[model samples]
Target chain A: MDVSNLGLIDFHAAYAIQERLVAQVASGEAPETLLLLEHPPVYTIGSGGSEANVLDPAISVVRTNRGGDVTWHGPGQLVGYPVIDLGRRGRDLHRYLRFLEELSIRVAGEFGVAARRVPGKTGIWTDRGKLASIGVGVRRWVAMHGFALNVAPDLEPFARINPCGMAGCPVTSLAREADAEPTVAEVAARVECLFPHLLNELLPCETETEGGRHVCCRLQVARGKAPLDVR
Target chain B: MATEITMPKLSDTMTEGRLISWKKGVGEQVNRGDIIAEVETDKANMELEAFTSGVLLETRVTPGELVPVGTVIGIVGAAGEAVAAAPVAVVPEPAVTETAAAAETAPAPAPEEPPPVHLSVAGEEAVKASPAVRRLARELGIDLQTVQGTGPDGRVLQEDLERLGGAGVTVAEPAAQPAVAETAPVAGTEPAAPRTELHDALPLSRMRSAIAQNVSTSWRTTPHFSVTVEIVMDAAAEVVRELREGGTPVSYNDLIVKACAMALFRFPQLNNSFAGDGIRMNADVNIGVAVGLPEGLLIPVVRECQRLSLREIAAESRRLAERARTGSISQQEISGGTFTISNLGMYGVDEFASIILPPQAAILAVGAVADRPVVRDGSVVAAKTMRATLSADHRIVDGLYVAQFLGEVKRLLENPVLMLV
Candidate 1:
């Protein structure tokens, strides 16, 4: 896995990088990559998201081809785009989402903050509020549009829209939960350190039969070994 | 042959998905990799690509329609080729409902002879048993067609299998079963095997029925282990009194909820649930305080206790309890409890263990805060003490974790000011 720390980049620039990396990885010209960056104040909605969730008409919203509702992105938040080819992997998109959540959970844990997954909801959360948001887009079995961790972002923008289509959803950050305030780069570093281990543990390469053609599919590592697979 | 396009499984956990829109219209030429539709799975929306090239012949489902995976949503075939009829057995219009004039003009086709009943032929007769009962019968090696159903409409039931098994028939019990003495206690106590005059049977109220069913389910499924701790509630009582004098109306249970929230923050395992094959760690410490009513009980939750102030929790718990007693509580108020606190302190009960609430890992049972003799400084002394037992699912947390959680709760209650900080 290749980790690039591209700090303070525009959302569109970061998305373009993700698109390029996805195409490269899908074509076997590049290794699986992790692009870490931060976006200026912006609100983005998933392709399936409803426009009615945006409470404030003034805030500009970017519609993207991802798998979640409207969410906020800004400088204080750490955005990570994991460009990986799922063809050689299990090709299970749900498991890929869980893998991203587990990465975020470990990153939060590195800062002495406890994060967990709420049943029937996608995101890593603390008791205080949700700590991270994850949405992905897959083109030809290549995943993009990864997760955003609230390191120390201004939560005011989130109140302008229903975060993940949930009304009155509370958002929290590492600065609030941890003993000391941490920067987005610091958190992204921890993510880069933890991503490969979790990816191997949760979404390891395996072989199984699919379409009755002896096509190799990934079998989940034993559930006990992969605790995050509880979802 | 026309190829049917079914909803694709986009995720491992998605049982069904919504068809957001069709990218291609009927009669549109489609290549093998053409995007045919967009689907909203449980996680996100993804484009559904065609696997084989053909012209779209029919659209079986409309946009925004939610259907189970593998349900055919469209048909694709060569140009000018007619699509095959759907596999569903189309029911013809009934001749029985026809008027007398229509029947006289054209004699209705002679009624087909009814097929001979073959009890052994599976799929010939539709069984009325639920999926669970059918599964149980299969596990017990009992054939549903042979067993006489005692339930309404002659439906085979779980109890029928039990009856068959007890009769020493074809049903085979698992080996290595422990032998129980005939003198074993059934239903706790059997009234000393003495006859008594029978009274009129009374039906269970809705609340009672719910309680019975819930507790039975919890007892049967949850492997519960309890740890008891004695806490000197002198400080907690003083804080409660101070709050009550200040018009906050704080109760002992409210203090316990505050303390439990703090302890749960430290030990997230206690706030977890025993999901099969793994555990679900709940992010919010939504403490459900069990409120006893005249008929039964209602546990109204004080949600996200980690964010609530002590005074706020007191007010919410009091309001919920009042609403529960008045039978005016909303569903949202009584649901989403990550942990539960059941107190019989008002009734002056000493101590008791509660059944672990399903999905939730643990329940804290708080006893009355009363004066009790304690040995302090190697001498007997009276102190305002209470006994609290934590019943937790062993599958999620062990006795050590439960003890540490209970100890933290005790530490917070004993040092009541720590909760404020």
Candidate 2:
């Protein structure tokens, strides 16, 4: 995976760059690349999001072609836009979402914040609140608009609207939960460092057995650290 | 053979998605890679593309209708294939579709839905009281039907019984009393109070109890400390004037909210909750503006202040304040506040600290902005000023951090234009 650290950038500018990279990766012209950066304070609603969930009418919201409700992006939050060709890996949006969630869980763990997925909810959460949000857009099986992890940004912006369309949703950051205050840049570096291992372990699971019967796959990371297998 | 098109799972959590619109109409020629329809998942909308070149034969779903993943939304086949051609092989099991439709269309289970009307055995209106309240009424020798309930839907409360004490109701002294304690009240036990006179014993309203419960919880659980700052609001006043003249009608309080949001963005620690062993940092900057109603206090949150401009904040604050004063504020409107700003400036107060709302780390109490003499560069000069006090959780943040956060707010307010970015 190729990694580029683009510090704080505008949402549209980064999105344009992502579309270009997505096209390149889709056509096999470029390697899978990760653009790690933060956005200047803005609220973005995906194609699946409703404007009704945005309670405050004064704030300008950008609607994008991504799956999910309204979400806020701004400084101090690490946004990882991975341009990867899922066509070659597996054209499985479900598996891709899980891959992103697992990657975020591992990254939060690196910062000493234990994060995991809640049943029926898409994102990484802790006892305190939601830590990372994953909303991906796939064009030609190339995924973009990946995930946003709260690092040390002001959470007050999330209050203006229901985060991810769930009212009274509590959004937390690594700096709030971890003993060590990790900057957005530091968290982005951690993601860049840890994503490859997580991708390898989570992406290649077979959804079917030798008998051709469909079986659910589970990642047993709790039993031991070294042994990883599909079950 | 007709190729079946099923709804795709665009996001991991999407079990169902709404069929937005059909880009290719039924019976239209569709080529491979052509956009077929638009589907809206819970989080986003995606364009479903045709995988096989064929004529659109039939559409099983309509626009704006939600269908489950793996349900055949449409079908494509040879141009001669009629729409009436049976596609039974591709149709989902009747039971599956029925259950999915039921789940999608059914209203959320309302626990508060009034109970089914029971046929009265004796044709008498049923008294609305809990079994426990009925049991207590039996012990207190009070007739429940005669008692005016203060609870929701006119249900009787325990406090209502205590208020009946001065009303000549006889108290049963025996521990083992018969269930027939529905005895008549003794005459001349106590003289009835004058109905026309002012009554001193006022029952606590539900709002009052709620306020008491919240403040008590915060007082007990949170270890709080306060920091006070005197802001020179000269530039902020000018900005307010310019905006009002420009028809924006922003107040000094709105300027304070924007400034505080910017400051909170820089000082994330102040926007965190002390969760015993660790601090829980909030994601959005929701600042609650305290609205003083005649009944009690209502802190309607001004959400996402970090993303809102001064004019926007002013409009939102004004709307919320209006709703609060009119008693039309909703539970959603007043909930989910990360920090609070309580201004008593209109009341002509100089400065006063406030209690931190629970689960939130801080609250800013603002005094009236008035003309005051201040020392600047060695000489006393008259400047418009305001004093703000921030009460914060000491467990989550120290005095130094609170002081610095307040200092940032002071800086933004003093400069005024610095908060625009």
TM-score of each: 0.56, 0.45
Tens digit of lDDT per residue, candidate 2, span B79-102?
A: 755332222222222112322233
lDDT of 2 by residue, A1-231 (tens): 688999989999999999899878967788788899989999998865779779999988998878788999998999998887665444556667777888898889998999976534678898678999988776766778889999999999999998987777889999999998998777887888887656655554223332432323343122224322110
**Candidate 2 Cα lDDT to native:** 0.73
| lDDT by residue for model 1 (A1-231), tens | 788889998889888888888879978899888888899998998877889789999888999878888999998999988887775565667778888888888889989998987666788988778899998887777888889999999888888998988867889999999999998878887888787667766766533332212323232334337555644
For all candidates, state DockQ relative to the true structure: 0.23, 0.15
The TM-score obtained by chain A of candidate 1 when compared with the true chain A? 0.90
- In terms of lDDT, model 1 sits at 0.75
Candidate 2 displacement at residue A103 in angstroms: 1.4
What TM-score does candidate 1 get on C-alpha atoms? 0.56
Q: Candidate 1 residues B1-421, lDDT tens each?
A: 4555666565556545677778899889988778888777655566777755779877776776665555556767677665443322111111122123322332222122111111243641476676545544432334566578899898877778655531112222222223343445456554554321111223355466567767887899899999999999998889888877987788788889999999999999999888878777677899999988778889998998999988899888888888999888865577779999999988899999999777899999988899999999999999999999999998888988988999899999999999776
